[model samples]
Target chain A: MRFAATVEVQLRPGIADPEGATIDKAIAALGIAGVSEVRAGRCFRFTVEAEDLASAEEVADSLGERLLSNPVIERHLTTIEALG
Target chain B: MSMRVAVVTFPGTNCEHDAIQGLEAVGAEAVFWWHTETSLDGIDAVVLPGGFAHGDYLRPGAIARFSPVMAAVADFAAQGGPVVGICNGFQVLTEAGLLPGALQKNAQLTFACQPCGLEVAQTSSVLTRGLEIGQHLEIPINHFSGSYVCDEATLASLEANDQVVLRYRQNPNGSVANIAGICNVAGNVVGLMPHPERAISPLLGSSDGLHLLGSLVSSLPAHR
Candidate 1:
Protein backbone atom coordinates (compact mmCIF):
# COMPACT_ATOMS: atom_id res chain seq x y z
CA MET A 1 0.00 0.00 0.00
CA ARG A 2 1.01 3.57 -0.64
CA PHE A 3 0.35 6.27 1.91
CA ALA A 4 0.87 10.00 1.73
CA ALA A 5 2.26 11.73 4.79
CA THR A 6 2.46 15.36 5.75
CA VAL A 7 4.71 16.38 8.60
CA GLU A 8 4.55 19.84 10.07
CA VAL A 9 7.65 20.90 12.02
CA GLN A 10 7.66 23.84 14.41
CA LEU A 11 9.80 25.31 17.13
CA ARG A 12 8.71 24.12 20.51
CA PRO A 13 6.85 26.59 22.71
CA GLY A 14 8.99 29.26 24.44
CA ILE A 15 11.73 28.93 21.85
CA ALA A 16 12.19 32.27 20.14
CA ASP A 17 10.95 32.27 16.54
CA PRO A 18 12.84 35.15 15.00
CA GLU A 19 11.57 34.57 11.47
CA GLY A 20 8.02 34.38 12.73
CA ALA A 21 8.48 37.54 14.77
CA THR A 22 9.87 39.38 11.75
CA ILE A 23 6.87 38.38 9.68
CA ASP A 24 4.53 39.50 12.44
CA LYS A 25 6.24 42.89 12.42
CA ALA A 26 5.73 43.10 8.68
CA ILE A 27 2.10 42.22 9.10
CA ALA A 28 1.64 45.07 11.58
CA ALA A 29 3.40 47.44 9.20
CA LEU A 30 1.04 46.50 6.39
CA GLY A 31 -1.88 47.91 8.48
CA ILE A 32 -3.35 44.51 9.09
CA ALA A 33 -5.31 44.65 12.31
CA GLY A 34 -5.70 42.00 15.00
CA VAL A 35 -2.94 39.81 13.55
CA SER A 36 -0.63 39.91 16.51
CA GLU A 37 1.28 36.64 16.78
CA VAL A 38 2.77 34.53 14.04
CA ARG A 39 4.88 31.38 14.03
CA ALA A 40 7.02 29.97 11.26
CA GLY A 41 7.44 26.27 10.47
CA ARG A 42 8.13 23.82 7.65
CA CYS A 43 5.82 21.25 6.09
CA PHE A 44 7.09 18.11 4.35
CA ARG A 45 4.83 15.94 2.20
CA PHE A 46 6.00 12.52 0.99
CA THR A 47 4.73 9.11 0.04
CA VAL A 48 5.63 5.94 1.93
CA GLU A 49 5.23 2.33 0.83
CA ALA A 50 4.18 0.06 3.65
CA GLU A 51 2.27 -3.13 4.32
CA ASP A 52 -0.69 -1.30 5.81
CA LEU A 53 -1.97 2.06 6.98
CA ALA A 54 -0.59 1.42 10.48
CA SER A 55 2.84 0.65 9.06
CA ALA A 56 2.68 3.76 6.90
CA GLU A 57 1.77 5.91 9.87
CA GLU A 58 4.71 4.39 11.75
CA VAL A 59 7.03 5.24 8.91
CA ALA A 60 5.84 8.83 8.84
CA ASP A 61 6.15 9.13 12.60
CA SER A 62 9.69 7.76 12.52
CA LEU A 63 10.63 10.18 9.79
CA GLY A 64 9.21 13.02 11.85
CA GLU A 65 11.12 11.96 14.94
CA ARG A 66 14.46 11.28 13.28
CA LEU A 67 14.99 13.41 10.19
CA LEU A 68 12.14 15.89 9.78
CA SER A 69 12.56 17.50 13.16
CA ASN A 70 15.25 18.26 15.74
CA PRO A 71 14.00 17.00 19.06
CA VAL A 72 16.12 19.58 20.89
CA ILE A 73 14.19 22.59 19.66
CA GLU A 74 11.47 21.47 17.29
CA ARG A 75 8.40 19.24 17.43
CA HIS A 76 6.54 17.68 14.52
CA LEU A 77 2.98 16.58 13.81
CA THR A 78 2.52 13.94 11.12
CA THR A 79 -0.64 13.03 9.28
CA ILE A 80 -0.92 9.98 7.03
CA GLU A 81 -3.54 8.95 4.52
CA ALA A 82 -4.06 5.90 2.36
CA LEU A 83 -3.41 6.28 -1.34
CA GLY A 84 -4.62 4.36 -4.36
CA MET B 1 55.75 13.45 14.22
CA SER B 2 52.91 15.69 13.04
CA MET B 3 49.35 15.18 14.21
CA ARG B 4 47.01 14.06 11.45
CA VAL B 5 43.62 15.77 11.58
CA ALA B 6 40.78 14.67 9.33
CA VAL B 7 38.74 17.55 8.03
CA VAL B 8 35.43 16.08 6.91
CA THR B 9 33.60 17.71 4.03
CA PHE B 10 29.98 17.24 3.13
CA PRO B 11 28.28 18.31 -0.06
CA GLY B 12 27.81 22.09 0.02
CA THR B 13 30.52 22.45 2.66
CA ASN B 14 32.68 25.41 1.63
CA CYS B 15 35.12 25.82 4.49
CA GLU B 16 37.00 22.53 4.37
CA HIS B 17 40.00 24.04 2.61
CA ASP B 18 40.27 26.86 5.07
CA ALA B 19 40.12 24.37 7.93
CA ILE B 20 42.83 22.30 6.30
CA GLN B 21 45.03 25.34 5.87
CA GLY B 22 44.43 26.41 9.43
CA LEU B 23 45.29 23.01 10.80
CA GLU B 24 48.47 22.85 8.73
CA ALA B 25 49.43 26.36 9.78
CA VAL B 26 49.37 25.08 13.35
CA GLY B 27 51.86 22.31 12.41
CA ALA B 28 49.33 19.48 12.03
CA GLU B 29 49.01 17.45 8.84
CA ALA B 30 45.44 17.95 7.67
CA VAL B 31 43.68 15.43 5.46
CA PHE B 32 40.36 15.52 3.66
CA TRP B 33 37.76 12.94 4.64
CA TRP B 34 34.78 12.80 2.37
CA HIS B 35 31.34 12.44 3.93
CA THR B 36 30.76 9.02 2.39
CA GLU B 37 33.68 7.39 4.18
CA THR B 38 32.97 5.71 7.52
CA SER B 39 36.45 5.27 8.85
CA LEU B 40 38.62 7.41 11.10
CA ASP B 41 41.65 5.16 10.91
CA GLY B 42 44.94 6.80 11.98
CA ILE B 43 43.20 10.15 12.39
CA ASP B 44 44.34 11.99 15.50
CA ALA B 45 41.44 14.42 15.51
CA VAL B 46 38.47 15.56 13.47
CA VAL B 47 37.29 19.01 12.43
CA LEU B 48 33.95 19.76 10.83
CA PRO B 49 34.37 23.01 8.97
CA GLY B 50 31.67 25.54 8.18
CA GLY B 51 29.38 26.14 5.16
CA PHE B 52 25.78 25.42 4.16
CA ALA B 53 25.99 21.65 4.38
CA HIS B 54 23.35 19.96 2.23
CA GLY B 55 22.39 23.47 1.13
CA ASP B 56 20.98 24.08 4.59
CA TYR B 57 17.86 22.18 3.56
CA LEU B 58 15.57 21.12 6.38
CA ARG B 59 17.61 23.48 8.55
CA PRO B 60 21.36 23.80 8.85
CA GLY B 61 23.23 20.56 9.47
CA ALA B 62 19.98 18.61 9.70
CA ILE B 63 20.49 16.35 6.71
CA ALA B 64 24.27 16.31 6.89
CA ARG B 65 24.11 14.65 10.30
CA PHE B 66 23.06 11.47 8.57
CA SER B 67 26.15 11.35 6.40
CA PRO B 68 28.23 8.17 6.75
CA VAL B 69 31.22 10.07 8.07
CA MET B 70 29.17 11.10 11.08
CA ALA B 71 29.01 7.55 12.39
CA ALA B 72 32.78 7.43 12.32
CA VAL B 73 32.95 10.86 13.86
CA ALA B 74 30.68 9.68 16.67
CA ASP B 75 32.85 6.66 17.32
CA PHE B 76 35.98 8.81 17.32
CA ALA B 77 34.39 11.17 19.81
CA ALA B 78 33.27 8.30 21.99
CA GLN B 79 36.88 7.15 22.21
CA GLY B 80 37.90 10.62 23.52
CA GLY B 81 39.37 11.75 20.23
CA PRO B 82 39.24 15.51 19.85
CA VAL B 83 36.45 16.80 17.60
CA VAL B 84 35.76 20.43 16.83
CA GLY B 85 32.86 21.80 14.79
CA ILE B 86 32.94 25.39 13.65
CA CYS B 87 29.95 27.48 12.44
CA ASN B 88 27.67 25.31 10.29
CA GLY B 89 29.72 22.38 11.53
CA PHE B 90 28.52 23.32 14.98
CA GLN B 91 24.98 22.86 13.74
CA VAL B 92 25.91 19.40 12.50
CA LEU B 93 27.34 18.36 15.84
CA THR B 94 24.18 19.44 17.59
CA GLU B 95 22.03 17.59 15.09
CA ALA B 96 24.20 14.49 15.51
CA GLY B 97 23.80 14.66 19.29
CA LEU B 98 27.58 14.86 19.70
CA LEU B 99 26.96 18.21 21.27
CA PRO B 100 23.98 19.55 23.13
CA GLY B 101 21.71 22.47 22.10
CA ALA B 102 20.72 23.80 18.73
CA LEU B 103 21.47 26.81 16.55
CA GLN B 104 18.49 28.96 15.63
CA LYS B 105 18.18 31.98 13.39
CA ASN B 106 19.82 35.03 14.81
CA ALA B 107 17.51 36.94 17.08
CA GLN B 108 18.06 40.04 14.97
CA LEU B 109 16.97 38.14 11.88
CA THR B 110 20.12 39.13 10.04
CA PHE B 111 23.30 37.48 8.85
CA ALA B 112 26.18 38.46 11.08
CA CYS B 113 29.59 38.74 9.46
CA GLN B 114 32.28 40.36 11.49
CA PRO B 115 35.21 39.84 13.83
CA CYS B 116 33.93 39.33 17.34
CA GLY B 117 35.47 39.13 20.77
CA LEU B 118 35.22 35.90 22.75
CA GLU B 119 36.16 35.04 26.32
CA VAL B 120 37.46 31.63 27.22
CA ALA B 121 35.13 30.11 29.77
CA GLN B 122 36.57 26.61 30.04
CA THR B 123 40.14 25.54 29.52
CA SER B 124 39.76 21.79 29.85
CA SER B 125 38.30 21.14 26.42
CA VAL B 126 40.46 20.23 23.43
CA LEU B 127 39.86 23.67 21.86
CA THR B 128 40.92 25.61 24.91
CA ARG B 129 43.17 23.22 26.75
CA GLY B 130 45.73 25.79 27.80
CA LEU B 131 43.71 29.01 27.53
CA GLU B 132 43.11 31.13 30.55
CA ILE B 133 39.71 31.69 32.01
CA GLY B 134 38.35 35.08 30.90
CA GLN B 135 41.10 35.31 28.27
CA HIS B 136 39.78 37.11 25.24
CA LEU B 137 40.35 36.47 21.56
CA GLU B 138 39.02 37.98 18.35
CA ILE B 139 37.57 35.67 15.72
CA PRO B 140 35.34 36.13 12.70
CA ILE B 141 31.75 34.90 12.72
CA ASN B 142 29.57 34.64 9.64
CA HIS B 143 26.21 33.01 9.99
CA PHE B 144 22.48 33.69 10.02
CA SER B 145 21.43 30.79 12.18
CA GLY B 146 24.06 31.10 14.90
CA SER B 147 21.99 31.58 18.00
CA TYR B 148 22.55 28.75 20.50
CA VAL B 149 19.49 27.48 22.32
CA CYS B 150 18.81 24.71 24.81
CA ASP B 151 16.44 23.81 27.60
CA GLU B 152 16.98 25.44 30.98
CA ALA B 153 17.99 22.13 32.49
CA THR B 154 20.62 21.61 29.84
CA LEU B 155 21.91 25.11 30.37
CA ALA B 156 22.19 24.51 34.08
CA SER B 157 24.17 21.31 33.58
CA LEU B 158 26.43 22.89 30.98
CA GLU B 159 27.29 25.56 33.48
CA ALA B 160 27.85 23.11 36.27
CA ASN B 161 29.98 20.76 34.20
CA ASP B 162 32.33 23.48 32.96
CA GLN B 163 31.23 22.63 29.45
CA VAL B 164 30.61 26.18 28.30
CA VAL B 165 33.89 26.77 26.46
CA LEU B 166 33.44 30.30 25.17
CA ARG B 167 31.19 33.33 25.57
CA TYR B 168 30.83 36.43 23.46
CA ARG B 169 32.10 39.64 24.95
CA GLN B 170 29.15 41.38 23.33
CA ASN B 171 26.27 39.21 22.23
CA PRO B 172 26.10 39.07 18.43
CA ASN B 173 23.27 36.55 17.84
CA GLY B 174 21.32 36.70 21.11
CA SER B 175 22.64 33.28 22.13
CA VAL B 176 21.60 32.22 25.56
CA ALA B 177 24.12 33.48 28.14
CA ASN B 178 26.03 34.93 25.21
CA ILE B 179 27.48 31.46 24.59
CA ALA B 180 29.88 31.39 21.65
CA GLY B 181 31.02 27.78 22.08
CA ILE B 182 30.54 24.70 24.20
CA CYS B 183 32.07 21.27 24.77
CA ASN B 184 30.51 17.99 25.70
CA VAL B 185 30.72 16.70 29.25
CA ALA B 186 33.76 14.62 28.30
CA GLY B 187 35.48 17.82 27.13
CA ASN B 188 36.82 16.11 24.00
CA VAL B 189 34.23 17.42 21.55
CA VAL B 190 33.52 21.12 20.98
CA GLY B 191 31.33 23.24 18.74
CA LEU B 192 31.49 26.98 18.23
CA MET B 193 29.88 29.51 15.91
CA PRO B 194 33.03 31.55 15.35
CA HIS B 195 35.26 30.72 12.38
CA PRO B 196 38.67 30.03 13.78
CA GLU B 197 39.97 28.94 10.39
CA ARG B 198 39.12 32.28 8.83
CA ALA B 199 41.02 34.08 11.56
CA ILE B 200 44.29 32.13 11.35
CA SER B 201 46.12 34.79 9.36
CA PRO B 202 47.15 38.19 10.66
CA LEU B 203 46.42 39.48 7.15
CA LEU B 204 42.76 38.56 7.78
CA GLY B 205 42.75 40.87 10.81
CA SER B 206 43.59 38.56 13.71
CA SER B 207 45.72 35.48 14.29
CA ASP B 208 44.20 34.91 17.72
CA GLY B 209 42.36 31.89 16.37
CA LEU B 210 45.68 30.10 16.27
CA HIS B 211 45.58 30.05 20.03
CA LEU B 212 42.57 27.76 19.91
CA LEU B 213 43.88 25.57 17.09
CA GLY B 214 47.29 25.40 18.73
CA SER B 215 45.66 24.16 21.89
CA LEU B 216 44.05 21.29 20.03
CA VAL B 217 47.34 20.30 18.41
CA SER B 218 49.24 20.45 21.67
CA SER B 219 46.65 18.47 23.61
CA LEU B 220 46.93 15.46 21.33
CA PRO B 221 48.89 12.52 22.75
CA ALA B 222 52.54 12.62 21.73
CA HIS B 223 53.08 10.54 18.55
CA ARG B 224 54.79 7.28 19.52
Candidate 2:
Protein backbone atom coordinates (compact mmCIF):
# COMPACT_ATOMS: atom_id res chain seq x y z
CA MET A 1 0.00 0.00 0.00
CA ARG A 2 0.99 3.58 -0.58
CA PHE A 3 0.35 6.30 1.94
CA ALA A 4 0.33 9.99 1.13
CA ALA A 5 1.89 11.83 4.03
CA THR A 6 2.04 15.47 4.86
CA VAL A 7 4.49 16.64 7.47
CA GLU A 8 3.89 20.09 8.88
CA VAL A 9 6.82 21.70 10.64
CA GLN A 10 6.84 24.85 12.72
CA LEU A 11 9.13 26.58 15.14
CA ARG A 12 8.27 25.93 18.74
CA PRO A 13 6.25 28.56 20.54
CA GLY A 14 8.35 31.06 22.56
CA ILE A 15 11.06 30.82 19.92
CA ALA A 16 11.33 34.05 18.01
CA ASP A 17 9.40 33.74 14.77
CA PRO A 18 11.12 36.47 12.86
CA GLU A 19 9.82 35.47 9.47
CA GLY A 20 6.30 35.22 10.79
CA ALA A 21 6.61 38.59 12.44
CA THR A 22 7.85 40.09 9.22
CA ILE A 23 4.86 38.71 7.38
CA ASP A 24 2.51 40.01 10.02
CA LYS A 25 3.92 43.49 9.60
CA ALA A 26 3.55 43.23 5.87
CA ILE A 27 -0.07 42.21 6.22
CA ALA A 28 -0.78 45.12 8.51
CA ALA A 29 0.83 47.46 6.03
CA LEU A 30 -1.69 46.30 3.43
CA GLY A 31 -4.55 47.79 5.52
CA ILE A 32 -5.97 44.37 6.29
CA ALA A 33 -7.88 44.40 9.59
CA GLY A 34 -8.58 41.73 12.19
CA VAL A 35 -5.38 39.92 11.32
CA SER A 36 -4.31 39.15 14.84
CA GLU A 37 -1.18 37.15 13.99
CA VAL A 38 0.73 35.20 11.44
CA ARG A 39 3.20 32.36 11.80
CA ALA A 40 5.35 30.64 9.20
CA GLY A 41 6.07 26.93 8.72
CA ARG A 42 6.80 24.41 5.99
CA CYS A 43 4.82 21.50 4.73
CA PHE A 44 6.41 18.42 3.19
CA ARG A 45 4.24 16.05 1.19
CA PHE A 46 5.52 12.67 0.15
CA THR A 47 4.37 9.14 -0.49
CA VAL A 48 5.55 6.23 1.61
CA GLU A 49 5.23 2.56 0.69
CA ALA A 50 4.15 0.22 3.48
CA GLU A 51 1.93 -2.77 4.20
CA ASP A 52 -0.66 -0.77 6.17
CA LEU A 53 -1.55 2.69 7.42
CA ALA A 54 0.02 1.97 10.81
CA SER A 55 3.29 0.95 9.22
CA ALA A 56 3.26 3.97 6.93
CA GLU A 57 2.59 6.30 9.83
CA GLU A 58 5.45 4.72 11.72
CA VAL A 59 7.85 5.22 8.86
CA ALA A 60 6.80 8.83 8.39
CA ASP A 61 7.04 9.55 12.10
CA SER A 62 10.65 8.43 12.19
CA LEU A 63 11.53 10.31 9.02
CA GLY A 64 9.81 13.42 10.32
CA GLU A 65 12.17 13.52 13.25
CA ARG A 66 15.37 12.49 11.51
CA LEU A 67 15.06 14.34 8.21
CA LEU A 68 11.88 16.39 7.85
CA SER A 69 12.18 18.63 10.90
CA ASN A 70 14.93 19.42 13.37
CA PRO A 71 13.82 18.64 16.89
CA VAL A 72 16.10 21.31 18.24
CA ILE A 73 13.96 24.15 16.91
CA GLU A 74 10.96 22.79 15.04
CA ARG A 75 7.98 20.63 16.00
CA HIS A 76 6.29 18.41 13.41
CA LEU A 77 2.87 16.87 12.96
CA THR A 78 2.28 14.07 10.49
CA THR A 79 -0.93 13.06 8.67
CA ILE A 80 -1.11 9.94 6.57
CA GLU A 81 -3.81 8.88 4.11
CA ALA A 82 -3.93 5.70 2.13
CA LEU A 83 -3.98 6.09 -1.66
CA GLY A 84 -5.66 3.86 -4.20
CA MET B 1 56.13 24.35 10.64
CA SER B 2 52.73 24.13 8.89
CA MET B 3 49.49 22.20 9.34
CA ARG B 4 47.38 20.64 6.59
CA VAL B 5 43.81 21.87 6.68
CA ALA B 6 41.15 20.59 4.33
CA VAL B 7 38.34 23.00 3.47
CA VAL B 8 35.40 20.92 2.36
CA THR B 9 33.54 22.45 -0.58
CA PHE B 10 29.97 21.60 -1.39
CA PRO B 11 28.42 22.49 -4.74
CA GLY B 12 27.14 25.88 -3.65
CA THR B 13 30.01 26.74 -1.33
CA ASN B 14 31.59 30.06 -2.22
CA CYS B 15 33.99 30.72 0.64
CA GLU B 16 36.47 27.84 0.35
CA HIS B 17 38.92 30.00 -1.53
CA ASP B 18 38.90 32.63 1.16
CA ALA B 19 39.32 29.93 3.78
CA ILE B 20 42.25 28.46 1.87
CA GLN B 21 43.94 31.83 1.48
CA GLY B 22 43.33 32.74 5.07
CA LEU B 23 44.75 29.46 6.42
CA GLU B 24 47.75 29.70 4.15
CA ALA B 25 48.38 33.28 5.26
CA VAL B 26 48.49 31.97 8.81
CA GLY B 27 51.14 29.31 8.03
CA ALA B 28 48.79 26.41 7.32
CA GLU B 29 48.61 24.54 4.03
CA ALA B 30 44.90 24.59 3.21
CA VAL B 31 43.43 22.55 0.38
CA PHE B 32 39.94 22.27 -1.10
CA TRP B 33 38.18 18.94 -0.78
CA TRP B 34 35.10 18.14 -2.81
CA HIS B 35 32.02 16.98 -0.96
CA THR B 36 31.98 13.71 -2.92
CA GLU B 37 35.36 12.57 -1.63
CA THR B 38 35.33 10.50 1.54
CA SER B 39 38.86 10.82 2.68
CA LEU B 40 40.82 12.98 5.09
CA ASP B 41 44.25 11.64 4.24
CA GLY B 42 47.15 13.73 5.54
CA ILE B 43 44.73 16.32 6.81
CA ASP B 44 45.57 17.82 10.18
CA ALA B 45 42.35 19.82 10.37
CA VAL B 46 39.08 20.33 8.52
CA VAL B 47 36.99 23.41 7.79
CA LEU B 48 33.43 23.73 6.57
CA PRO B 49 33.24 27.14 4.97
CA GLY B 50 30.09 29.20 4.47
CA GLY B 51 27.73 28.51 1.56
CA PHE B 52 24.25 27.32 0.56
CA ALA B 53 25.19 23.67 0.33
CA HIS B 54 22.72 21.57 -1.68
CA GLY B 55 20.94 24.84 -2.22
CA ASP B 56 19.94 24.60 1.43
CA TYR B 57 16.93 22.60 0.14
CA LEU B 58 15.48 21.28 3.39
CA ARG B 59 17.45 23.64 5.57
CA PRO B 60 21.00 24.84 5.76
CA GLY B 61 23.18 21.77 6.25
CA ALA B 62 20.30 19.32 6.34
CA ILE B 63 20.98 17.85 2.92
CA ALA B 64 24.70 18.40 3.05
CA ARG B 65 25.11 16.34 6.20
CA PHE B 66 24.33 13.25 4.14
CA SER B 67 27.14 13.97 1.70
CA PRO B 68 29.78 11.30 1.37
CA VAL B 69 32.59 13.41 2.84
CA MET B 70 30.62 14.06 6.01
CA ALA B 71 31.25 10.52 7.24
CA ALA B 72 34.97 11.07 6.95
CA VAL B 73 34.60 14.45 8.61
CA ALA B 74 32.66 12.87 11.46
CA ASP B 75 35.33 10.22 11.89
CA PHE B 76 38.02 12.87 11.84
CA ALA B 77 36.16 14.80 14.50
CA ALA B 78 35.76 11.62 16.59
CA GLN B 79 39.51 11.03 16.47
CA GLY B 80 40.10 14.46 18.04
CA GLY B 81 41.20 16.19 14.87
CA PRO B 82 40.13 19.81 15.00
CA VAL B 83 37.05 20.66 12.90
CA VAL B 84 35.63 24.15 12.60
CA GLY B 85 32.46 25.12 10.73
CA ILE B 86 31.91 28.72 9.74
CA CYS B 87 28.50 30.10 8.77
CA ASN B 88 26.82 27.47 6.63
CA GLY B 89 29.45 25.01 7.78
CA PHE B 90 28.30 25.72 11.31
CA GLN B 91 24.74 24.93 10.26
CA VAL B 92 25.88 21.65 8.77
CA LEU B 93 27.76 20.68 11.91
CA THR B 94 24.68 21.24 14.01
CA GLU B 95 22.51 19.35 11.53
CA ALA B 96 24.99 16.50 11.55
CA GLY B 97 24.59 16.28 15.32
CA LEU B 98 28.24 17.08 15.90
CA LEU B 99 27.32 20.20 17.81
CA PRO B 100 24.41 21.16 20.00
CA GLY B 101 21.68 23.66 19.15
CA ALA B 102 20.39 24.88 15.79
CA LEU B 103 20.57 28.04 13.71
CA GLN B 104 17.31 29.79 13.02
CA LYS B 105 16.37 32.95 11.15
CA ASN B 106 17.82 36.02 12.75
CA ALA B 107 15.53 37.67 15.24
CA GLN B 108 15.55 40.78 13.09
CA LEU B 109 14.27 38.79 10.12
CA THR B 110 16.94 40.11 7.79
CA PHE B 111 20.17 38.97 6.28
CA ALA B 112 22.75 40.50 8.59
CA CYS B 113 26.13 41.39 7.14
CA GLN B 114 28.36 43.40 9.36
CA PRO B 115 31.14 43.29 11.89
CA CYS B 116 29.95 42.06 15.27
CA GLY B 117 31.62 41.93 18.65
CA LEU B 118 32.39 38.55 20.21
CA GLU B 119 33.53 37.53 23.67
CA VAL B 120 35.60 34.45 24.28
CA ALA B 121 33.52 32.36 26.66
CA GLN B 122 35.91 29.43 26.79
CA THR B 123 39.61 28.87 26.21
CA SER B 124 40.12 25.11 26.20
CA SER B 125 38.56 24.19 22.84
CA VAL B 126 40.63 23.75 19.69
CA LEU B 127 38.91 26.84 18.23
CA THR B 128 39.75 29.24 21.06
CA ARG B 129 42.77 27.87 22.96
CA GLY B 130 44.99 30.73 21.83
CA LEU B 131 42.75 33.30 23.47
CA GLU B 132 42.01 33.95 27.08
CA ILE B 133 38.51 33.80 28.42
CA GLY B 134 36.61 37.09 28.15
CA GLN B 135 38.75 38.27 25.25
CA HIS B 136 36.96 40.53 22.79
CA LEU B 137 36.91 40.04 19.03
CA GLU B 138 35.32 41.88 16.09
CA ILE B 139 34.31 39.49 13.34
CA PRO B 140 32.00 39.72 10.34
CA ILE B 141 28.66 37.86 10.27
CA ASN B 142 26.77 37.32 7.00
CA HIS B 143 23.76 35.11 7.24
CA PHE B 144 20.00 35.20 7.58
CA SER B 145 19.55 32.05 9.67
CA GLY B 146 22.29 32.50 12.20
CA SER B 147 20.31 32.61 15.39
CA TYR B 148 21.41 29.82 17.74
CA VAL B 149 18.68 27.98 19.58
CA CYS B 150 18.57 25.02 21.99
CA ASP B 151 16.43 23.62 24.76
CA GLU B 152 16.84 24.84 28.34
CA ALA B 153 18.42 21.61 29.43
CA THR B 154 20.89 21.68 26.57
CA LEU B 155 21.73 25.30 27.26
CA ALA B 156 22.38 24.45 30.88
CA SER B 157 24.58 21.56 29.87
CA LEU B 158 26.49 23.72 27.42
CA GLU B 159 27.22 26.18 30.20
CA ALA B 160 28.04 23.52 32.78
CA ASN B 161 30.49 21.84 30.42
CA ASP B 162 31.96 25.14 29.24
CA GLN B 163 31.08 24.06 25.72
CA VAL B 164 29.93 27.56 24.88
CA VAL B 165 33.00 29.05 23.24
CA LEU B 166 31.96 32.44 21.92
CA ARG B 167 29.18 34.79 22.97
CA TYR B 168 28.15 37.87 21.11
CA ARG B 169 29.17 40.91 23.08
CA GLN B 170 25.98 42.52 21.76
CA ASN B 171 23.90 39.47 20.80
CA PRO B 172 23.46 40.35 17.12
CA ASN B 173 21.26 37.37 16.19
CA GLY B 174 19.12 36.66 19.24
CA SER B 175 20.90 33.42 19.97
CA VAL B 176 19.88 31.93 23.28
CA ALA B 177 22.29 33.03 25.98
CA ASN B 178 23.99 35.15 23.33
CA ILE B 179 25.78 32.03 22.14
CA ALA B 180 27.73 32.77 18.98
CA GLY B 181 29.78 29.61 18.98
CA ILE B 182 30.05 26.28 20.76
CA CYS B 183 32.31 23.24 20.98
CA ASN B 184 31.48 19.60 21.39
CA VAL B 185 32.09 17.93 24.74
CA ALA B 186 35.37 16.61 23.40
CA GLY B 187 36.44 20.17 22.50
CA ASN B 188 37.71 19.17 19.07
CA VAL B 189 34.63 20.25 17.08
CA VAL B 190 33.33 23.81 16.98
CA GLY B 191 30.59 25.60 15.03
CA LEU B 192 29.96 29.32 14.80
CA MET B 193 28.06 31.77 12.60
CA PRO B 194 30.68 34.45 12.15
CA HIS B 195 33.06 34.26 9.23
CA PRO B 196 36.45 33.98 10.87
CA GLU B 197 38.26 33.48 7.58
CA ARG B 198 36.88 36.78 6.38
CA ALA B 199 38.45 38.54 9.36
CA ILE B 200 41.99 37.28 8.89
CA SER B 201 43.33 40.36 7.08
CA PRO B 202 43.56 43.84 8.54
CA LEU B 203 42.65 45.29 5.17
CA LEU B 204 39.49 43.20 5.22
CA GLY B 205 38.63 45.10 8.44
CA SER B 206 40.01 43.02 11.31
CA SER B 207 42.62 40.42 12.18
CA ASP B 208 40.71 38.90 15.08
CA GLY B 209 40.01 35.68 13.15
CA LEU B 210 43.72 34.93 12.96
CA HIS B 211 43.74 34.40 16.68
CA LEU B 212 40.86 31.92 16.34
CA LEU B 213 42.38 30.08 13.39
CA GLY B 214 45.76 30.17 15.07
CA SER B 215 44.21 28.40 18.03
CA LEU B 216 43.14 25.59 15.71
CA VAL B 217 46.66 25.31 14.33
CA SER B 218 48.30 25.36 17.73
CA SER B 219 45.87 22.79 19.09
CA LEU B 220 46.88 20.20 16.53
CA PRO B 221 48.80 17.12 17.65
CA ALA B 222 52.56 17.41 17.77
CA HIS B 223 54.57 16.55 14.61
CA ARG B 224 51.69 17.29 12.23
Residue A9 CA error for candidate 1 (Å)? 0.7
Superposed by TM-score, candidate 1 places the C-alpha of residue B216 at a distance from the truth, in angstroms, of 0.5
Give stretches of model 2 more than 4 Å off: B222-224
Chain A TM-scores of all predicted models: 0.95, 0.95
* lDDT score, candidate 1: 0.93
Candidate 2, residue A53: Cα displacement in angstroms equals 0.9
- The estimated TM-scores of all candidates read 0.97, 0.96
Residue pairs whose backbone atoms clash in candidate 2: none
Candidate 2 DockQ, CA atoms: 0.90
* Residue B95 miss distance in model 2 (angstroms): 0.2
DockQ of each: 0.89, 0.90
The worst-scoring run of ten residues by lDDT in candidate 1 chain A lies at: A28-37
Residue-level lDDT of model 2, residues A29-49, one tens digit each, is 999988966889999999999
